[model samples]
Target chain A: MVRPGGRSARVQASVHAAVRELEAEVGREALTVPLVATRAGVTPSTIYRRWGDLQELLSDVAVERLRPETAPEDKGSLRSDLEAWAEQFLEEMSAPTGRAYIRDALLGGPDGTNAGQCSAYAAEQIDVILDRAADREENAPDVETVLDRVVAPMMYRILFRPEGLDTAYARQLAVGLVGSNDR
Target chain B: MVRPGGRSARVQASVHAAVRELEAEVGREALTVPLVATRAGVTPSTIYRRWGDLQELLSDVAVERLRPETAPEDKGSLRSDLEAWAEQFLEEMSAPTGRAYIRDALLGGPDGTNAGQCSAYAAEQIDVILDRAADREENAPDVETVLDRVVAPMMYRILFRPEGLDTAYARQLAVGLVGSNDR
Candidate 1:
């Protein structure tokens, strides 16, 4: 059911909206192909044609929804750039959707299942931050280390523990991860 | 049914064997109070006497079967301590059973059903490493920082990623986290 030319603006909007609604209601699991098609009032074929498969569709939606907000505007120093990155990371985690995403990543599942998706997504995000840090000659460690030490713990505390994610904790992690990179 | 005092050593051994067999076959999901009692050749009441509920019995079995091995002799440095921890963490993630346990934690289902059980179990494991690190004044960073950076990341990586735990990546994290505290 491909539109004669390409997916119409309305069809794309409807598909995106369907994904958002499902994700909000029940995390990532509930967004099955049929469910999204039904919600979008489009044929399943339409979704398949546009997004290829469930994972691709979900990944696309996840990327759009979970994209880190505005990149840091050229902070003069590595420390300041990292501080900006940490603040942004904390802001993302504080949101309801961000918390849900973190829980899914942490407790997600085993290898070859959907469990790896969140961590992979997170690693990509860290790469972006690391690239920014690298531009300033900072000794930002590899993406995996950044994720394991800095991002995962914050998400874990927020999702599983009663202890809340606060500015103070975020700042501490910032100092430990970024400032300590060279020291 | 209360074992009329206490079960004979043979009876206790039989019960433990049954638990091990059931866990090995169908996993924790397939385990049931009645099935365990039947396999053990004991009355349900007898099983209840020893363990108050199915989950308790399962938890006991889990603790016995999946207990962490003793840490390696410390090399009097944070780097060695972290590497020892990383090796153990990788070993834990290598098992199908361990992966399933983590998957269950994430999808512990609605209503906050298994949340407390999962949280308490994870906290106990974390406490062991945290306490051990705390004893090493020369090598370990402050307790809170170690927990945040080193411990949390290891757990998160094991439970989430499909790839072999990145030992070099973890080594770098340990150095960065502990080295920063020295300054």
Candidate 2:
């Protein structure tokens, strides 16, 4: 997507791309402002002046990259809709890049930087599903409830445990949250 | 708890204490093996040989510190028992030191060093509660189920959000997991 802007927008885009590429190659731990500056064809001073620190740059990158590229299509039922959304989410988050993005977003800080934006994006997806369900006379759980019951647990295990998330796990969570086995 | 051992065990204990103190003082991000070695009155070479890296040393300290000092006492029923356990667990984890321990434990690695041990310890707590409920002819959800439905969500928010955990949250989780409000 090309942004209709001048030199400032071009530099911002370049920096964002550099951060993502560097993060993927060396992992989040190894990424540095100097390295990003080199990769983005900008000076270290520019990066420092624009973002203040690596954490803030990471927060910006995470906020941009972690948001769903497109909204999930509304499936017929709450169960199917939730499962589909979760499956897509899990798939995205299972990749090394996605995982790194989420880790930065989540473990960043209490400051309303990346984590808050990322969470709000996630909550919007849940709201889309719940709103669709309400239209079908289905009593869907609230966004926080669904997040607590399904999304948080899946992400918890994925981040902390060796076990990977799968479709079956997503289905089970959907059933658990919705209190129904109907597919 | 004193472990009856020679020079190696004593060194390990001192190093662990130093790690905890340093973590509490400077937070985990600023902690280093050299600092810990200096504080513990050991050579940096010793730390390098035993723990391999700062992350590994952190994993060890976190595994040791994050485990419950004593198993939670079983209340009469599953609901009360779960609520009691969760409240205590949340209280411990809400502290800065405890939160640091948990962050180290959870975000430590995919290496299965600290995360595996920490998860096992948590599973054991769940087992104790379930076993007690079984003795009273009451049904209890499996460890994974309870973790998915209750503990994971709590931990996720604790780590990611600024919101602190409380008894009300614990009670709601207990009720949600057990599928009943009956005590």
Candidate 3:
């Protein structure tokens, strides 16, 4: 039996596929709703109704691409787990394409739901790390603190200054948080 | 001397004044570039050329308005100063109008220069607090740490999950940083 959003998922898949193909062919600058819709076998109105506009559609696709497909790596300790997770987070988010995706995620209009979804992904990873710490009886900071201390700074640097983001910087934040919190 | 950007400054002032007046009268939805140009006594081309378009003009003005006009209030100690600054920052950034301005500021096209300017304002305030701490010989987190620990979290909360942002929460971040860093 098909799930509730099966048809919708198919449409989204086709649309995303169309975008990738067109991007590779003519590039992002020359893309439009009609062209993408034609390639995806959906009407232009459908694209507009669902995604609001071409830019939002592109942002939706990019944000979806950014969704983590697998759990963060297990590094045996809370500190190492956080460091590894944060390093991957910074690497993916600090690249040029990643930066564009981050920017577009926030620009999801007044509701700003896309940015919230992105934050939730980070929070989930932190929770996993915290759970590992719990199992090991190791001290740990709360997920909120991890978000505030590690993830926020990386994202802040990515969006604004956008320089000097590296594994060392990411590891520093994790180590500092772990040190202060005894986690 | 008139200064290099004299005419540009006047145009910006008149345009800003026009936006405020029109926002109060006709409301934001009804605003158009030609209408603002006529009101500000400049040609539409001037507004378009300088600001790119109506949305860009509106964003430029909002970012300009968001710029800090004065130095952060000094409270003698680094902890108090950071707490005060962070609380004020969260309050301003989480407010409805402030949120809109921030969104627009980042939406300032590909360069994202407005976001950079906003970061500079916070960094400058942080520097002042650090300098004060230095004078008092109080151990203090560096400017980057302050940006990471306090300001980044506040901004992340503001942009993503905007609820539950308040003075107490802001104070907690500042106080926690000080406790950790011996400042």
Candidate 4:
């Protein structure tokens, strides 16, 4: 539901808190509109009016939780920074909790807004790395290219065939992109 | 439901027909077990017993539809063959219906069986191309590498950011895999 300005942060905060508590107590699958409303001491219509549905609310909450906690670690060279970031991304995104968040982010929206937001987060980090290389007069591909070559494959592996993934694989993707044998 | 041998092909055929018709008539979002059961002339319990839920049943139908209709076209060289196959794969998978099928195959179950089956179809085609290169005694990477470098990224792009994907992008992925530079 689109408000004239935006949703009230106060309501959002309490609802989100209720969702987290209910998710912990009863898990994600069992969450319902009435359950969340009762926990938050609001009517079910409040949730429906604000979020449209449970999946939408869940996606909103997941997107909030998935916001990057810190900037990508600086590891000197472009390749090293990308490799380190890629490794960390794979590690976190392949964990059970990370996997669930990814699913929640994607499966909640048919419009692709949440999924696109997640991708944008990765792109912002990639751009920071690219900007660093530019500052250092080092050659680095654009953010989209890195996303296509390095991050995309890793995400596919994470979401599907995760058996062959490792930090070495992450480093290999960075090397393929940079094309230097100095690793 | 796990039968002594397997589910009856007749029941499956009728149920699939009902689902397809209902999907066309009411669309996927409006589908329900009762609606499908009434259409198929079967009890709702039968559907639950057989497929566990509407999503699982939808996934099963999608998997059947997603099976490759023909082998990867033979283009006289491994590079050409792979390029041709990758272009076709990307084209089909990025289309609206293809995207729906991929989503159906994935979003149904946490068990990953349906998604794994779809990946297997792609892997089987990749192996056929690999076998041809091996028969010609040319240098070639393994199926896993092709999957990692080529298909995985393409899938990620299809599922997320599909703006930059095209036949040229598909060919470039093929070139990256088989780098003779004679294309």
Candidate 5:
């Protein structure tokens, strides 16, 4: 769908795209507003006047791009639903673009501002899966419980550990969380 | 306990201590070899000859410092053992010295070298707890499973989320991992 508004919206899109592209190319640490402006075909003055500084610009870009690209789908059971959600979540998180956004948000963007947005986006997607699962079962684990048991561990490995995350890892995690509750 | 070796051992201990002190003071980003050498009362040439780079030096110091201070005690059951381990782990990790070591390991040190050492250290401690629990009960969850269920999420929150980690969080995590297997 076409984004609303005219020149200003176009500029925003261009700048955001440029920031992501540069992040992918150079990594977040090497990113600069002047470099981003040059890539977006916008002036440094416009970037500075609009975003204030590199941290704010990165935060805004992360908030925009780090959201789930597509809505999570509902599967019949909680196990299947969680697995599907986690698979998609892991896939997005492991991608270069997603990695760039997360790296910047965690490392460079202001305190919790951008990182919280990323966490919120994941939580929102997980909530959709959990809600669907609750309809089929007598009881469903709360979001915080699910987060602590499943999502947080997966995220920790993704960000810190050298172990690779795949659909199998996602399935195991989903099974661990959901299977334990079967009794 | 007195570490073995002669002048080399003393020099190594002094240099490691200086690196930890400076890291706690200014953080890893502001750390430099010359600064560390000066603080350690050693020449820059000695530092360069010994470690080659700041990352190498930090990794060595991190490896030496990040080890668990003492063996985790066996607490009869998996739940109590895990809770005790997590409590000590969280307390150490949240301390300024622990935070400095972790920060340097995660951010400034080489790719997997130092970070892997830190992870291995935690894994070793967790293994001891799990082994004791296993002797008490058949089919105890393995270290990997326990880590995914208990430790990963806690570490994610500690490193990324703004929330403080306390003994209560540790107890909850231990319970979640151990209590689920009671079917």
Candidate 6:
């Protein structure tokens, strides 16, 4: 079965299972190849052959978590679209696992390149929100600035602190960011 | 000299020298107390006697780097104050060592507490701009949003990339962020 071929379905399944187990036990730090192999009952060489290193494996895993569910589908108006976007960001801030993954990505260790991936994800999300305000081209800068300053900080405060994401704060951010008129 | 006594000037100098050398050589990862002591030509006992551990030593070094320069005496208007802030931020982004130190402080290590120190530094810098805006509190939130989205990213791009700090981009960010006010 091991004739210099790609990983078998069974092997892939085992590796996926091992990654979850390792993450649960020691978080991102323990996602090393040797650890994953040991947990999966596979040799280190098998992992190395399938995925070059832990980063490649972790990148794949991290990408899987990048769901676009938060990007509003057609909120009818620019204001509502922005509110939805801010709400999604707040949801991410409230979830411990979401915060942990972000911190891990930013920490830039064995998986430092993950920062770029995460940044790209954020940029894309921002693009979607900005798209709604494009017809009112004068509002582009204001929309972008609000998203970064007000909306973004709400996520950041909760991410860095032990406190839960505050709904009132999120509401304040959305309204202030998407003010009644153009900048 | 190594006995239990009050801290001395010579010991402080050695610690600073050790920190500078440690950061120059291996960034922040290899900044252990033993490593600092060996490089400083001081015994580990002497080093340990001075600072509790790597974190304590690093935090002190960070504080020294964060001492604020005097803000412009009077930049004429709020726009000028913001433009000056962007220029100052750009200057720090221009230095390779400064950029690396800030990144490490912000992203932090495997433990994740270092980022907090970095955030505090950023908050202080942001406060300076905020206080300046408070001088004319009409559009403080708007000013802050611009700083967060535009000025901050320009610094990050310039510092972390091969392009170095972009003076033109800084100017654009400052101007765009605080457009020709209704004045």
- The global Cα lDDT (0 to 1) of model 5 is 0.75
In the range B28-122, model 6's lDDT, one tens digit per residue, is 77678888888877888886676666766675566457555664445656666666666776777556555555554444333445545544555
Q: 2 or 4, which is superior by TM-score?
A: 4
* Clashes by residue pair, model 3: none
Per-residue lDDT value at A148 in model 6: 49
DockQ of all candidate complexes: 0.36, 0.53, 0.72, 0.65, 0.45, 0.21
TM-score of chain A of 1: 0.62
Q: Which scores better on TM-score, 2 or 6?
A: 2
Residue by residue across B27-144, what tens digits does model 5's lDDT show? 7779898899899999988888877788678767866788778879876777777878887777777666666566557654435466666778888988887777667774467877
TM-score of each candidate structure, all chains considered together: 0.62, 0.87, 0.90, 0.91, 0.78, 0.68
lDDT of 6 by residue, A1-183 (tens): 333444586787788688877898897764689889999999999988887777666655654465455666556555666666667767775576776655445444342356556555656776776776785553654433553455446644543333444666566566666657433
Per-chain TM-score (chain B), model 1? 0.61
User: What DockQ would you assign to candidate 6?
Assistant: 0.21
* Model 1 stretches astray by more than 4 angstroms: A1-16, A22-37, A42-64, A69-73, A104-117, A130-142, A159-162, A180-183, B1-23, B26-82, B109-139, B159-161, B164-183
Model number with the top DockQ: 3
Off by over 4 Å in 2: A1-11, A23-30, A49-52, A110-112, A179-183, B1-7, B23-30, B179-183
Q: Local distance difference test, per candidate? A: 0.63, 0.79, 0.85, 0.85, 0.75, 0.60
Q: TM-score ranking from best to worst? A: 4, 3, 2, 5, 6, 1
Per-residue CA lDDT of model 3 for A44-145, tens digit only, reads 998888888887888777778788989888888887888899999999998877887877788776687788888888888889889989999898989988
Candidate 2's DockQ: 0.53
Candidate fnat values, all: 0.50, 0.60, 0.69, 0.50, 0.52, 0.10
lDDT (tens digit, per residue) of candidate 5 on A97-171: 666566557654335566667778878888887777767663678887777777787777665675666878877
Ten contiguous residues minimizing lDDT sum, candidate 2 chain A: A106-115
Task: Give lDDT tens digits, candidate 4, residues A48-148.
Answer: 99889998899888877877889888778888888888888888888887878787787666777887788888898898888988987887788878987
Per-prediction tally of clashes: 0, 0, 0, 1, 0, 0
Task: Output DockQ, candidate 3.
Answer: 0.72
| Ten-residue region with minimum lDDT total, candidate 3 chain B | B1-10
Which should have the higher lDDT, number 1 or number 4? Answer: 4
Residue lDDT tens for model 2, A79-100: 8888888877777776776777
